[model samples]
Target: MNVRARPFIPAALAVLIGCTAFTSVQADEVQVAVAANFTAPIQAIASDFEKDTGHKLIAAYGATGQFYTQIKNGAPFEVFLAADDTTPERLEKEGDTVPGSRFTYAIGTLALWSAKEGYIDGTDKALLANQYTHLSIANPKAAPYGLAATQVLAKLDLTDKVKNKIVEGQNITQAYQFVSTGNAELGFVALSQIYKNGKVSDGSAWIVPEAMHDPIRQDAVILKKGENNPAAKALADYLKGPKATAIIKSYGYHL
Candidate 1:
Protein backbone atom coordinates (compact mmCIF):
# COMPACT_ATOMS: atom_id res chain seq x y z
CA MET A 1 0.00 0.00 0.00
CA ASN A 2 1.07 3.61 -0.51
CA VAL A 3 0.79 4.05 3.26
CA ARG A 4 3.79 1.67 3.36
CA ALA A 5 4.48 -0.06 6.54
CA ARG A 6 5.71 0.91 9.97
CA PRO A 7 7.72 3.99 8.99
CA PHE A 8 10.91 1.93 9.03
CA ILE A 9 11.99 2.27 12.66
CA PRO A 10 12.31 6.11 12.48
CA ALA A 11 15.51 7.98 11.56
CA ALA A 12 15.32 9.54 15.06
CA LEU A 13 15.73 6.07 16.65
CA ALA A 14 18.87 5.41 14.64
CA VAL A 15 20.29 8.80 15.60
CA LEU A 16 19.57 8.08 19.27
CA ILE A 17 21.37 4.72 19.07
CA GLY A 18 24.41 6.37 17.48
CA CYS A 19 24.48 9.08 20.12
CA THR A 20 24.37 6.42 22.87
CA ALA A 21 27.33 4.67 21.38
CA PHE A 22 29.29 7.90 21.15
CA THR A 23 28.59 8.76 24.76
CA SER A 24 29.66 5.30 25.90
CA VAL A 25 32.93 5.66 24.04
CA GLN A 26 33.57 9.09 25.48
CA ALA A 27 32.91 7.95 29.04
CA ASP A 28 35.64 5.31 29.06
CA GLU A 29 38.43 6.47 31.38
CA VAL A 30 40.48 9.23 32.99
CA GLN A 31 44.06 9.89 31.91
CA VAL A 32 46.91 11.69 33.65
CA ALA A 33 50.05 13.18 32.15
CA VAL A 34 52.88 13.05 34.65
CA ALA A 35 56.38 14.53 34.57
CA ALA A 36 59.15 11.94 34.19
CA ASN A 37 61.02 13.04 37.32
CA PHE A 38 58.25 11.79 39.58
CA THR A 39 57.79 8.47 37.83
CA ALA A 40 58.44 5.98 40.63
CA PRO A 41 56.46 7.63 43.41
CA ILE A 42 53.59 8.47 41.11
CA GLN A 43 53.36 4.90 39.96
CA ALA A 44 52.91 3.82 43.55
CA ILE A 45 50.44 6.59 44.17
CA ALA A 46 48.42 5.70 41.11
CA SER A 47 48.18 2.10 42.29
CA ASP A 48 46.86 3.24 45.66
CA PHE A 49 44.46 5.67 44.03
CA GLU A 50 42.95 3.00 41.81
CA LYS A 51 42.56 0.66 44.73
CA ASP A 52 41.00 3.20 47.05
CA THR A 53 38.68 4.96 44.61
CA GLY A 54 37.95 2.24 42.08
CA HIS A 55 38.92 4.63 39.34
CA LYS A 56 41.35 3.71 36.60
CA LEU A 57 44.25 6.07 36.00
CA ILE A 58 46.06 5.82 32.73
CA ALA A 59 49.36 7.62 33.26
CA ALA A 60 51.67 8.97 30.57
CA TYR A 61 55.15 9.99 31.74
CA GLY A 62 57.27 12.39 29.74
CA ALA A 63 58.92 15.75 29.85
CA THR A 64 56.57 18.34 31.31
CA GLY A 65 57.11 20.57 28.30
CA GLN A 66 56.04 17.83 25.90
CA PHE A 67 52.98 17.04 27.97
CA TYR A 68 52.12 20.73 28.09
CA THR A 69 52.22 20.92 24.32
CA GLN A 70 50.09 17.79 24.02
CA ILE A 71 47.49 19.06 26.46
CA LYS A 72 47.23 22.35 24.58
CA ASN A 73 46.56 20.35 21.42
CA GLY A 74 43.80 18.38 23.18
CA ALA A 75 45.55 15.18 24.19
CA PRO A 76 42.73 14.49 26.69
CA PHE A 77 44.51 14.36 30.00
CA GLU A 78 42.39 15.12 33.06
CA VAL A 79 45.33 15.97 35.29
CA PHE A 80 48.92 17.19 34.97
CA LEU A 81 51.68 16.72 37.51
CA ALA A 82 54.70 18.75 36.47
CA ALA A 83 58.33 18.65 37.54
CA ASP A 84 58.24 22.33 38.44
CA ASP A 85 55.86 25.16 39.21
CA THR A 86 56.55 27.01 35.97
CA THR A 87 54.64 24.86 33.47
CA PRO A 88 51.63 24.34 35.70
CA GLU A 89 51.50 28.09 36.25
CA ARG A 90 51.64 28.64 32.52
CA LEU A 91 48.83 26.14 31.90
CA GLU A 92 46.70 27.77 34.55
CA LYS A 93 47.29 31.16 32.98
CA GLU A 94 46.29 29.79 29.59
CA GLY A 95 43.11 28.37 31.13
CA ASP A 96 44.10 24.84 30.12
CA THR A 97 44.05 23.87 33.77
CA VAL A 98 41.39 24.43 36.39
CA PRO A 99 41.97 27.78 38.06
CA GLY A 100 42.99 27.69 41.72
CA SER A 101 43.46 23.92 41.68
CA ARG A 102 47.25 24.01 41.47
CA PHE A 103 49.38 23.07 44.46
CA THR A 104 52.88 21.91 45.23
CA TYR A 105 52.92 18.22 46.00
CA ALA A 106 56.62 17.72 46.70
CA ILE A 107 60.07 19.25 46.43
CA GLY A 108 62.54 17.26 44.37
CA THR A 109 66.20 16.78 45.12
CA LEU A 110 68.98 16.77 42.53
CA ALA A 111 71.91 14.42 42.75
CA LEU A 112 75.00 13.72 40.68
CA TRP A 113 75.11 9.95 40.57
CA SER A 114 77.50 7.33 39.21
CA ALA A 115 77.23 3.57 39.05
CA LYS A 116 80.98 3.46 39.47
CA GLU A 117 81.97 3.78 43.13
CA GLY A 118 83.72 7.03 44.16
CA TYR A 119 83.42 8.50 40.70
CA ILE A 120 81.97 11.79 42.00
CA ASP A 121 83.87 12.20 45.28
CA GLY A 122 80.91 14.14 46.79
CA THR A 123 81.82 17.40 45.10
CA ASP A 124 80.28 19.39 42.26
CA LYS A 125 83.77 20.02 40.79
CA ALA A 126 83.82 16.44 39.54
CA LEU A 127 81.77 17.63 36.59
CA LEU A 128 84.59 19.91 35.45
CA ALA A 129 87.44 17.64 36.43
CA ASN A 130 86.54 15.41 33.49
CA GLN A 131 86.74 12.54 35.91
CA TYR A 132 84.16 10.83 33.72
CA THR A 133 84.03 10.76 29.94
CA HIS A 134 80.27 11.11 29.62
CA LEU A 135 77.78 12.93 31.83
CA SER A 136 74.02 12.89 31.47
CA ILE A 137 71.57 15.64 32.26
CA ALA A 138 67.97 16.24 31.36
CA ASN A 139 67.15 18.72 28.60
CA PRO A 140 66.99 22.04 30.41
CA LYS A 141 64.07 23.23 28.31
CA ALA A 142 61.97 20.18 29.11
CA ALA A 143 62.86 19.07 32.62
CA PRO A 144 63.39 21.15 35.77
CA TYR A 145 66.16 18.94 37.10
CA GLY A 146 68.15 19.78 33.99
CA LEU A 147 67.92 23.45 34.80
CA ALA A 148 69.16 22.75 38.29
CA ALA A 149 72.04 20.76 36.94
CA THR A 150 72.99 23.61 34.70
CA GLN A 151 72.89 26.03 37.58
CA VAL A 152 75.08 23.78 39.68
CA LEU A 153 77.61 23.49 36.89
CA ALA A 154 77.60 27.21 36.30
CA LYS A 155 78.14 27.88 39.97
CA LEU A 156 81.14 25.60 39.91
CA ASP A 157 82.31 27.28 36.66
CA LEU A 158 82.32 23.85 35.10
CA THR A 159 79.63 24.45 32.51
CA ASP A 160 82.23 25.14 29.83
CA LYS A 161 84.38 22.20 30.86
CA VAL A 162 81.57 19.66 30.87
CA LYS A 163 79.39 21.11 28.12
CA ASN A 164 81.04 19.07 25.41
CA LYS A 165 80.85 15.84 27.31
CA ILE A 166 77.20 16.28 28.24
CA VAL A 167 74.60 13.87 26.95
CA GLU A 168 71.12 15.22 27.22
CA GLY A 169 68.09 13.11 28.04
CA GLN A 170 64.55 14.20 27.23
CA ASN A 171 63.61 13.90 30.87
CA ILE A 172 65.01 13.09 34.31
CA THR A 173 64.09 9.41 34.20
CA GLN A 174 66.10 8.91 31.07
CA ALA A 175 68.99 10.86 32.54
CA TYR A 176 69.05 8.42 35.44
CA GLN A 177 68.85 5.56 33.00
CA PHE A 178 71.81 6.86 31.03
CA VAL A 179 74.08 6.59 34.06
CA SER A 180 72.60 3.29 35.22
CA THR A 181 72.99 1.74 31.78
CA GLY A 182 76.59 3.01 31.49
CA ASN A 183 75.80 5.20 28.52
CA ALA A 184 77.00 8.04 30.72
CA GLU A 185 79.44 7.57 33.55
CA LEU A 186 77.52 10.01 35.75
CA GLY A 187 74.40 12.16 35.54
CA PHE A 188 72.12 14.40 37.48
CA VAL A 189 68.97 12.59 38.56
CA ALA A 190 66.17 13.00 41.02
CA LEU A 191 67.00 11.78 44.52
CA SER A 192 64.08 9.41 44.52
CA GLN A 193 65.63 7.24 41.83
CA ILE A 194 68.07 5.57 44.20
CA TYR A 195 66.20 5.84 47.47
CA LYS A 196 64.99 2.61 49.03
CA ASN A 197 63.73 2.28 52.59
CA GLY A 198 64.97 5.73 53.52
CA LYS A 199 68.44 4.92 52.22
CA VAL A 200 70.43 5.87 49.17
CA SER A 201 71.53 3.42 46.48
CA ASP A 202 74.81 1.53 46.34
CA GLY A 203 76.27 3.92 43.81
CA SER A 204 78.05 7.11 44.85
CA ALA A 205 76.01 10.31 44.79
CA TRP A 206 76.55 13.95 45.60
CA ILE A 207 73.27 15.51 46.71
CA VAL A 208 73.24 19.00 45.32
CA PRO A 209 72.77 21.51 48.09
CA GLU A 210 69.45 23.35 48.04
CA ALA A 211 71.23 26.71 47.83
CA MET A 212 72.56 25.84 44.41
CA HIS A 213 69.33 26.67 42.64
CA ASP A 214 65.73 27.65 43.04
CA PRO A 215 63.73 25.06 44.88
CA ILE A 216 62.35 22.23 42.82
CA ARG A 217 58.75 22.74 43.83
CA GLN A 218 56.92 20.04 41.93
CA ASP A 219 53.31 21.03 41.40
CA ALA A 220 50.12 19.23 40.42
CA VAL A 221 47.11 20.79 38.77
CA ILE A 222 43.64 19.75 37.66
CA LEU A 223 43.21 20.12 33.94
CA LYS A 224 40.27 22.07 32.55
CA LYS A 225 39.22 18.81 30.95
CA GLY A 226 38.78 17.40 34.43
CA GLU A 227 37.06 20.30 36.17
CA ASN A 228 34.08 18.12 36.90
CA ASN A 229 35.82 14.80 37.20
CA PRO A 230 35.45 13.52 40.74
CA ALA A 231 38.18 10.93 40.37
CA ALA A 232 40.72 13.44 39.15
CA LYS A 233 39.98 15.82 41.98
CA ALA A 234 40.15 12.99 44.50
CA LEU A 235 43.55 11.91 43.24
CA ALA A 236 44.84 15.48 43.32
CA ASP A 237 43.72 15.94 46.89
CA TYR A 238 45.12 12.57 47.94
CA LEU A 239 48.54 13.60 46.68
CA LYS A 240 48.65 16.46 49.15
CA GLY A 241 47.34 14.39 52.00
CA PRO A 242 49.40 12.76 54.78
CA LYS A 243 49.52 9.27 53.32
CA ALA A 244 50.91 10.35 50.01
CA THR A 245 53.24 12.87 51.60
CA ALA A 246 54.76 10.16 53.74
CA ILE A 247 55.35 8.02 50.70
CA ILE A 248 56.88 10.93 48.81
CA LYS A 249 59.14 11.84 51.68
CA SER A 250 60.24 8.27 52.09
CA TYR A 251 61.43 8.37 48.55
CA GLY A 252 63.68 11.36 49.42
CA TYR A 253 61.43 14.15 48.20
CA HIS A 254 61.36 17.11 50.52
CA LEU A 255 57.93 17.70 52.01
Candidate 2:
Protein backbone atom coordinates (compact mmCIF):
# COMPACT_ATOMS: atom_id res chain seq x y z
CA MET A 1 0.00 0.00 0.00
CA ASN A 2 1.42 3.39 -1.03
CA VAL A 3 0.22 6.70 0.44
CA ARG A 4 1.00 10.04 -1.13
CA ALA A 5 2.09 12.55 1.50
CA ARG A 6 2.14 16.31 1.27
CA PRO A 7 5.17 18.51 1.97
CA PHE A 8 5.97 18.82 5.66
CA ILE A 9 4.79 21.95 7.45
CA PRO A 10 6.91 23.52 10.15
CA ALA A 11 4.98 24.08 13.40
CA ALA A 12 5.06 27.92 13.46
CA LEU A 13 4.54 28.32 9.71
CA ALA A 14 1.80 25.68 9.77
CA VAL A 15 -0.11 27.56 12.48
CA LEU A 16 0.14 30.81 10.54
CA ILE A 17 -0.89 29.20 7.25
CA GLY A 18 -3.64 27.12 8.87
CA CYS A 19 -5.13 30.12 10.69
CA THR A 20 -5.44 31.98 7.40
CA ALA A 21 -6.81 28.96 5.52
CA PHE A 22 -9.35 28.21 8.25
CA THR A 23 -10.99 31.61 7.86
CA SER A 24 -10.30 32.31 4.19
CA VAL A 25 -10.32 29.10 2.16
CA GLN A 26 -13.73 27.59 1.64
CA ALA A 27 -14.21 24.39 3.56
CA ASP A 28 -14.31 21.21 1.49
CA GLU A 29 -16.20 18.21 2.78
CA VAL A 30 -14.71 14.84 1.84
CA GLN A 31 -17.37 12.29 1.11
CA VAL A 32 -16.17 8.96 2.43
CA ALA A 33 -17.54 5.47 1.78
CA VAL A 34 -16.36 3.49 4.80
CA ALA A 35 -16.69 -0.14 5.84
CA ALA A 36 -19.05 -0.75 8.75
CA ASN A 37 -16.44 -2.43 10.94
CA PHE A 38 -14.49 0.83 11.04
CA THR A 39 -17.45 3.01 12.03
CA ALA A 40 -16.40 3.76 15.62
CA PRO A 41 -12.72 4.54 15.08
CA ILE A 42 -13.36 6.48 11.88
CA GLN A 43 -15.84 8.71 13.72
CA ALA A 44 -13.16 9.53 16.30
CA ILE A 45 -10.64 10.21 13.51
CA ALA A 46 -13.14 12.42 11.69
CA SER A 47 -13.70 14.61 14.76
CA ASP A 48 -9.98 15.20 15.23
CA PHE A 49 -9.40 15.69 11.50
CA GLU A 50 -12.09 18.36 11.29
CA LYS A 51 -10.50 20.24 14.16
CA ASP A 52 -6.94 19.83 12.89
CA THR A 53 -7.48 20.61 9.21
CA GLY A 54 -10.68 22.66 9.30
CA HIS A 55 -12.17 20.15 6.84
CA LYS A 56 -15.40 18.21 7.25
CA LEU A 57 -15.85 14.48 6.63
CA ILE A 58 -19.20 13.08 5.51
CA ALA A 59 -18.95 9.34 5.94
CA ALA A 60 -21.23 6.57 4.67
CA TYR A 61 -20.73 3.20 6.36
CA GLY A 62 -21.62 -0.20 4.88
CA ALA A 63 -20.08 -3.34 3.49
CA THR A 64 -16.96 -2.83 1.37
CA GLY A 65 -18.45 -4.85 -1.48
CA GLN A 66 -21.50 -2.58 -1.66
CA PHE A 67 -19.30 0.50 -1.63
CA TYR A 68 -17.21 -1.01 -4.45
CA THR A 69 -20.35 -1.50 -6.56
CA GLN A 70 -21.49 2.04 -5.78
CA ILE A 71 -18.10 3.49 -6.60
CA LYS A 72 -18.07 1.69 -9.94
CA ASN A 73 -21.37 3.40 -10.74
CA GLY A 74 -20.11 6.86 -9.65
CA ALA A 75 -21.55 7.28 -6.16
CA PRO A 76 -19.97 10.76 -5.78
CA PHE A 77 -17.78 9.52 -2.95
CA GLU A 78 -14.35 11.14 -2.71
CA VAL A 79 -12.71 8.61 -0.45
CA PHE A 80 -13.11 4.90 0.24
CA LEU A 81 -12.15 3.17 3.48
CA ALA A 82 -12.52 -0.49 2.79
CA ALA A 83 -12.57 -3.36 5.31
CA ASP A 84 -10.17 -5.32 3.10
CA ASP A 85 -7.45 -4.23 0.69
CA THR A 86 -9.02 -6.23 -2.14
CA THR A 87 -11.85 -3.75 -2.92
CA PRO A 88 -9.60 -0.71 -3.02
CA GLU A 89 -7.08 -2.51 -5.19
CA ARG A 90 -9.86 -3.57 -7.52
CA LEU A 91 -11.09 0.01 -7.69
CA GLU A 92 -7.62 1.29 -8.49
CA LYS A 93 -7.12 -1.35 -11.15
CA GLU A 94 -10.45 -0.36 -12.69
CA GLY A 95 -9.44 3.34 -12.70
CA ASP A 96 -11.82 4.42 -9.96
CA THR A 97 -9.17 6.00 -7.75
CA VAL A 98 -6.18 8.31 -7.90
CA PRO A 99 -3.14 6.29 -8.85
CA GLY A 100 -0.78 5.15 -6.05
CA SER A 101 -3.04 6.51 -3.31
CA ARG A 102 -3.89 3.21 -1.69
CA PHE A 103 -2.58 2.31 1.77
CA THR A 104 -3.36 0.10 4.72
CA TYR A 105 -4.95 2.10 7.52
CA ALA A 106 -5.45 -0.66 10.04
CA ILE A 107 -5.53 -4.41 10.58
CA GLY A 108 -8.78 -5.59 12.19
CA THR A 109 -9.59 -8.43 14.57
CA LEU A 110 -12.67 -10.67 14.61
CA ALA A 111 -14.34 -11.97 17.74
CA LEU A 112 -17.26 -14.13 18.86
CA TRP A 113 -19.64 -12.03 20.93
CA SER A 114 -22.86 -12.52 22.88
CA ALA A 115 -25.28 -10.02 24.37
CA LYS A 116 -26.13 -12.16 27.37
CA GLU A 117 -23.54 -12.30 30.11
CA GLY A 118 -22.07 -15.76 30.74
CA TYR A 119 -23.99 -17.06 27.76
CA ILE A 120 -20.68 -17.98 26.18
CA ASP A 121 -17.44 -19.18 27.71
CA GLY A 122 -13.75 -19.75 27.06
CA THR A 123 -14.55 -23.08 25.50
CA ASP A 124 -16.79 -22.97 22.40
CA LYS A 125 -18.73 -26.05 23.42
CA ALA A 126 -22.00 -24.19 22.91
CA LEU A 127 -21.19 -23.82 19.21
CA LEU A 128 -21.07 -27.56 18.80
CA ALA A 129 -23.95 -27.96 21.26
CA ASN A 130 -26.11 -25.86 18.90
CA GLN A 131 -27.78 -24.23 21.88
CA TYR A 132 -28.11 -20.81 20.29
CA THR A 133 -31.15 -20.30 18.10
CA HIS A 134 -29.39 -18.04 15.64
CA LEU A 135 -25.80 -17.06 14.86
CA SER A 136 -25.48 -13.73 13.13
CA ILE A 137 -22.77 -12.81 10.66
CA ALA A 138 -22.28 -10.26 7.91
CA ASN A 139 -22.74 -11.62 4.38
CA PRO A 140 -19.58 -13.49 3.37
CA LYS A 141 -19.73 -12.24 -0.20
CA ALA A 142 -20.00 -8.65 0.99
CA ALA A 143 -18.05 -8.43 4.22
CA PRO A 144 -14.48 -9.41 5.09
CA TYR A 145 -15.39 -10.18 8.69
CA GLY A 146 -18.11 -12.52 7.52
CA LEU A 147 -15.60 -14.32 5.33
CA ALA A 148 -13.33 -14.72 8.32
CA ALA A 149 -16.20 -16.07 10.38
CA THR A 150 -16.92 -18.64 7.72
CA GLN A 151 -13.28 -19.65 7.67
CA VAL A 152 -13.30 -20.21 11.43
CA LEU A 153 -16.46 -22.28 11.25
CA ALA A 154 -15.02 -24.37 8.44
CA LYS A 155 -11.81 -24.94 10.37
CA LEU A 156 -13.89 -26.23 13.25
CA ASP A 157 -15.92 -28.39 10.89
CA LEU A 158 -19.11 -26.76 12.15
CA THR A 159 -20.23 -25.09 8.93
CA ASP A 160 -22.48 -27.94 7.80
CA LYS A 161 -24.14 -28.37 11.20
CA VAL A 162 -24.65 -24.64 11.80
CA LYS A 163 -25.63 -23.63 8.27
CA ASN A 164 -29.34 -23.79 9.13
CA LYS A 165 -28.89 -21.58 12.21
CA ILE A 166 -27.03 -18.72 10.51
CA VAL A 167 -28.50 -15.30 9.99
CA GLU A 168 -26.61 -12.99 7.64
CA GLY A 169 -26.53 -9.21 7.94
CA GLN A 170 -25.66 -6.69 5.26
CA ASN A 171 -22.56 -5.58 7.12
CA ILE A 172 -20.51 -6.11 10.25
CA THR A 173 -22.24 -3.24 12.08
CA GLN A 174 -25.64 -4.82 11.52
CA ALA A 175 -24.27 -8.20 12.56
CA TYR A 176 -22.95 -6.72 15.79
CA GLN A 177 -26.29 -5.10 16.41
CA PHE A 178 -27.98 -8.45 15.97
CA VAL A 179 -25.99 -9.90 18.88
CA SER A 180 -25.92 -6.73 20.97
CA THR A 181 -29.69 -6.39 20.80
CA GLY A 182 -30.19 -10.11 21.52
CA ASN A 183 -31.82 -10.67 18.15
CA ALA A 184 -29.28 -13.48 17.94
CA GLU A 185 -27.73 -15.10 20.97
CA LEU A 186 -24.22 -14.94 19.60
CA GLY A 187 -22.49 -13.56 16.53
CA PHE A 188 -19.18 -13.05 14.85
CA VAL A 189 -18.21 -9.36 14.89
CA ALA A 190 -15.25 -7.06 14.66
CA LEU A 191 -13.30 -6.69 17.89
CA SER A 192 -13.32 -2.91 17.57
CA GLN A 193 -17.11 -2.89 17.87
CA ILE A 194 -17.19 -4.87 21.10
CA TYR A 195 -13.85 -3.80 22.57
CA LYS A 196 -13.40 -0.22 23.79
CA ASN A 197 -11.54 1.63 26.58
CA GLY A 198 -9.29 -1.40 27.08
CA LYS A 199 -11.98 -4.08 27.37
CA VAL A 200 -15.11 -5.58 25.93
CA SER A 201 -18.12 -3.28 26.40
CA ASP A 202 -20.74 -5.93 27.17
CA GLY A 203 -21.24 -9.66 27.65
CA SER A 204 -18.55 -12.25 26.98
CA ALA A 205 -16.36 -12.52 23.90
CA TRP A 206 -13.64 -14.65 22.41
CA ILE A 207 -10.91 -12.79 20.52
CA VAL A 208 -10.52 -15.05 17.52
CA PRO A 209 -6.93 -16.04 16.82
CA GLU A 210 -5.40 -14.53 13.72
CA ALA A 211 -4.59 -18.00 12.48
CA MET A 212 -8.28 -18.75 12.35
CA HIS A 213 -8.61 -16.57 9.29
CA ASP A 214 -6.68 -14.41 6.87
CA PRO A 215 -5.30 -11.08 8.10
CA ILE A 216 -7.85 -8.32 7.64
CA ARG A 217 -5.76 -5.55 6.11
CA GLN A 218 -8.04 -2.53 5.74
CA ASP A 219 -7.08 0.07 3.17
CA ALA A 220 -8.17 3.58 2.17
CA VAL A 221 -7.94 5.27 -1.19
CA ILE A 222 -8.68 8.65 -2.74
CA LEU A 223 -11.13 8.30 -5.61
CA LYS A 224 -10.35 9.61 -9.10
CA LYS A 225 -13.17 12.13 -8.65
CA GLY A 226 -11.21 13.55 -5.72
CA GLU A 227 -7.93 13.97 -7.61
CA ASN A 228 -8.05 17.74 -7.12
CA ASN A 229 -9.73 17.71 -3.70
CA PRO A 230 -7.39 18.81 -0.93
CA ALA A 231 -9.73 17.64 1.82
CA ALA A 232 -9.83 14.14 0.43
CA LYS A 233 -6.03 13.87 0.35
CA ALA A 234 -5.70 15.52 3.75
CA LEU A 235 -8.03 13.04 5.40
CA ALA A 236 -6.08 10.14 3.92
CA ASP A 237 -2.84 11.54 5.27
CA TYR A 238 -4.38 12.25 8.66
CA LEU A 239 -5.39 8.61 8.87
CA LYS A 240 -1.68 7.76 8.96
CA GLY A 241 -0.78 10.33 11.58
CA PRO A 242 0.15 9.51 15.17
CA LYS A 243 -3.05 10.83 16.75
CA ALA A 244 -5.28 8.99 14.32
CA THR A 245 -3.31 5.76 14.61
CA ALA A 246 -3.60 5.96 18.39
CA ILE A 247 -7.34 6.44 18.19
CA ILE A 248 -7.65 3.45 15.86
CA LYS A 249 -5.49 1.35 18.15
CA SER A 250 -7.64 2.28 21.14
CA TYR A 251 -10.54 0.71 19.33
CA GLY A 252 -8.70 -2.67 19.33
CA TYR A 253 -7.40 -2.56 15.74
CA HIS A 254 -3.74 -3.13 14.93
CA LEU A 255 -1.85 -0.37 13.15
Find the candidate with the highest lDDT and give its number: 2
User: Which candidate ranks first by TM-score, i.e. highest?
Assistant: 2
Write the residue-wise lDDT of candidate 1 on 139-251 in tens digits: 99989999999998898888888888999999998999999999999999998998879767768888889999889999999999998887788888889887788889989
Q: With candidate 2 superimposed using the best TM-score fit, by how many Å does residue 242's alpha carbon deviate from the native?
A: 0.7
Clashing pairs in 2: none
Candidate 2 stretches with Cα past 4 Å from truth are 1-26
Model 2 gets an lDDT of 0.92
Displacement of residue 149 (Cα, Å) in model 2 is 0.6
Local distance difference test, per candidate? 0.87, 0.92
| Decoy 1 TM-score against native | 0.86
